[model samples]
Target: MIQTVNGKIDAKDLGITMCHEHFIIDLSKVRGEDDSTLQDTKLMLKEVEKLKALGCQAVVEVTANDMGRDVIKLREISKAAGLHIIASTGFYLAPYHPKWLQESTIEDLKALFKKEITEGIEGTGIKAGIIGEVATSKNKILQTEEKVLRAAARASKELDCAVSTHCDMGTMGNEQVELMLSEGAHPDKLILGHIDLVSDILYHKGILEKGVNLAFDTIGKTKYLTDEKRADHLFALLDAGYEDHLLLSQDVSRKSYLCSYGGKGYTAVLGYFIDLLKERGISKPQLDKMLIHNPARILDRAC
Candidate 1:
């Protein structure tokens, strides 16, 4: 079964899921950016409603604890929007961690993650279904980020949940994957996010070689890379036989990234990017695997 904000459900119930997203978050504490704050539940629910209208059945909110994770609010949004919402546990990038995290040992961090997974997050009784958006820097994994990643690897191994990670501008994926593997994390239960930011097949292939799933989840952020370019890389990987090891999302967190704020809403992946993939020669079956099968398999923890 997969844990949702509302409760647990069979993996088959997690249909057409966007593997990475943010429904309610506040990154201002970390980035001091106004756009990063997704504070309005009403607005978030409206955006999610648009996604549901487009046939999105579930969304994995990758908002980790340090990234203003509000599981209580998420539960409300999930109920109101009628979308299965899978919440996350674990911290985000180094800057987002609390002061104690830097001094904490891997075992200390592991226990925290394990508690949230097995029990619930911060005494809310809303168990997290996944173990990340654990973030890393552009060139290297910082000391704190390393601790979190190793702890996440251990916790995910124990809890049997997927560990999704943020690859800053698409770097350090190889290192992150190697580190998770070194800690004996299941490769199939690992997701390396934002690789589409790099736009290099060889870079992606090297990380995929480690047998971890890749999230082409930064779709619709044309300022960084066009959706067409992201599709090109995705199709290339599919052609190379990595369809089962891939997932899709917009990674939409900032207010400006939402259509309500003049950006593509949560429905972009289902409403826009999927059509773009079809136009680019990606078959219906491949689209189904990325949007449905791949995420369901990774997020499900029925063992």
Candidate 2:
């Protein structure tokens, strides 16, 4: 079963999921920017409704605990938008980690993550479905960040949940995979995010060689990379027979990325990019693997 904000459900029911996203979060603690906060439920629901129209039934909200995770708010948003929202449980990068986290042992961190997954987050009865967006720095995983990643991996192994991660500027994918695997995370259950920002097919191939999934998330965030370039790189992977190992999402966390705030909204990948892929001669089966089957493979937990 895949745990969602509403409760455990069959993994096959998590239809057309965006593997990485954020909603009802405040990143001001780490970003030092007020615009990073996505607090308006009314506005968020309008954007989510657009995604639903494009057949987005679920979204994995990967906002970590240190990044202003609000389970109650997530539940409210999922119910209001009629989307199956998966909450996450883990620390992010070192900077986002709480001062107390710096002192906690790996076992301490593991227990907390397990509690959130098996019990409930903060006594709210809202369990986290996934074990990440656990992250590292640009070039290396900090000692603190490594501890959290290991703990998250251990927790995921115990709970049979998937693990997602934030790859800064698309760096350290290989190292992240090594660490998670060393800590007993199955490669198929691991997803490395923001890979589209790298633009290096070899860098992506290196990570894929480790048997992990790659999230071409951050779609429509043209300031970092264009969707055309993203599509080009994605086609290379599909051509190389890695379609089953790919996932898609927008990772829209800011007000500027939301349609209600004059941005593209959550429908960019399903609404716009899929059409771009078809124009590029991507067949229907390949598109289905990327959009539906790939996410299902990575996110479907054995119940």
Poorest lDDT segment (10 consecutive residues) of candidate 2: 294-303
In model 1, the number of clashes is: 0
Q: After best superposition, candidate 2 residue 251: deviation in angstroms? A: 0.6
The Cα RMSD in angstroms, rounded to one decimal, for candidate 1 relative to the true structure is 1.0
Angstrom error of the Cα, residue 196, model 1: value is 0.6
TM-score of each prediction: 0.98, 0.97
User: How many clashes show up per model?
Assistant: 0, 1
Candidate 1 residue lDDT tens string, 1-303: 899988899988788999999988888986878999997999988888888899999999999999888999999998888889999988888888999997899999999988888789989998989998899998988999999999999988888889999999989999998899999899999999998899789999888988889998888888999888888888888989999999999999898888897888887788888888888788888888999999999988863
Off-target runs (Cα >4 Å) in candidate 1 are none
Give lDDT tens digits, candidate 2, residues 13-71.
77788989998788897789988998878888888889999999889999888888998
Q: List the residue pairs that clash in candidate 1.
A: none
The residue pairs that clash in candidate 2, if any, are: 1-303
